[model samples]
Target: MKKKIKFMLLVYTLFLLSACSLRKDIHSYQKIETECDEIVQYLSEDDTEGLKSMFCNMTRSSSEFDKQIQVAMDYFEGKVIEHDPFTLKNDGSSVENGKITRLYSSPHLTGIVTDVGKTYEIKFYSYIINTDDEDKVGISKLTIKTDNGNECIIGEYIR
Candidate 1:
């Protein structure tokens, strides 16, 4: 009987740890989704500064992130950006039973044209957030794809 109680206690302890951090995770997910929606809005209005802020929040303080945001700013200003009807998210920014402490953005899809009028699909390939509470951030590696199946990194930015 003592052995059974000890085993039950062990399981209970694990469950408590996982549940303690869960409510926070759920709130963070809501924020990410809300942010992505706001980004689409900024894209629609061609808001350059707003775009920069939105993208910057996802990246570390790197020059690479700065450059990509410029590209995004330029693209929105001149080239046409047609956002898809629905945003795409892999694994849905969620963890099982709540114990999730990670923050992530859903992969975003947008159609863009260069200044010279070349067209490409811009897809966010990276959205990394530090698991720790530190202020560090990471840029998501992004790829631009032409209809012909060729792809290249347009920019690595904190998105």
Candidate 2:
């Protein structure tokens, strides 16, 4: 009877550990999604400064700032008609341990050009990772394009 109780205790401990790990992953994914939403909001409002604040260190230089603003303004000239949160996709197995990984895909946004009476779809990709200090989330590899297949902006940095 004592042996059975010990075995059950061990199993319970393992289950609790797994649950904790799963919770952490879900939390991280939600955080990433929230960050992506903020990006969409900034772009939709043409808030260039707010959008630039999301970039990572490597790409957030004075020289690149104005250009970044231009690209966003040019791509999203009119008010945003629709915006969607980024969806996570499985990125396949990692080589190190064959662990299944997930990544954020390009979120979709649509805007109407009132001047031309044309609607445009904007798709942009962002990668989020935990910073070295583990206190902040870092964002990088921002690439934006229009429905016409024009690569309007590409950001290389993490913030």
The TM-score leader among the candidates is 2
Q: How much does candidate 2 score in TM-score?
A: 0.65
TM-score of 1: 0.49
Query: Every model's Cα RMSD, please?
Result: 6.9, 5.7
Error of 2 at 107 (Å): 6.9
- Candidate 2 regions off by >4 Å? 89-137, 157-159
Clashes of each: 2, 3
Task: Give the distance in Å from residue 99's predicted Cα in candidate 1 to where it truly belongs.
Answer: 13
lDDT of 1: 0.53
lDDT of 2 by residue, 88-136 (tens): 5421111223332333334454442334344555444444443242322
In candidate 2, list every pair of residues with a backbone clash: 56-157, 56-158, 56-159
Return the lDDT, model 2, position 50.
Answer: 80
- Candidate 1 clashing pairs? 59-158, 126-140
Top-scoring candidate (lDDT): 2
Model 1: CA > 4 A from native: 57-106, 109-122, 125-154, 157-159
